[model samples]
Target: MTYVFNMHDAKTKLSKLVELAESGQRVQIARNGKVVVELNVVAKKSRPLFGEFKPLNIWTSEDFDEPVQEWIDAFAISQSELELQSNKK
Candidate 1:
């Protein structure tokens, strides 16, 4: 079904018009009695999959998932050592 509404009428019924368009009906808004714009349900986009960056020429190193030494050392320190370091700051 197709629905047409004048500018003022469309403004007051904007939400209803959107609902109609989303339900697969054609909705049009007019200005000065001539149709000028349409309301449509936009097609939803799919989320990109994992490792989809290859098309963009981006690559990761083999060691990207390896444990980082600095992070390991930070986590290995004792709670007292962390408190002493904070006090020194």
Candidate 2:
């Protein structure tokens, strides 16, 4: 979800906003309803403790690595929710 706040509100709720941003939400701090700054979760590089799993490269179909439709739908739903939240602001 995207969160919107004015400068004062953003400052006052900095901690809470950070917590939300850490959870993959976008936050926009506005001045007079004009967006000034945005906070978002930064993508982190992931490392396995032991090592990375090697791909077998045995898949036969071109769509083998494609995301399932259900997952795509879920993502779409999530995006829609974020858009809705943005509209509210």
Question: Which structure among the candidates has the greatest lDDT?
Answer: 1
What tens-digit string does per-residue lDDT give for candidate 1 at 38-63? Answer: 99799999888998755666799999
In candidate 2, stretches whose alpha carbon ends up further than 4 angstroms from where it belongs are 45-89
lDDT at 52, model 2: 73
The local distance difference test score of model 1 is 0.91
Candidate 1, TM-score vs. the true structure?
Answer: 0.55
Model 2, residue pairs in steric clash: none
User: What's the lDDT for residue 1 in model 1?
Assistant: 86
Top TM-score: which candidate number? 1
Q: Which 10 residues in a row give candidate 2 its minimum summed lDDT?
A: 50-59
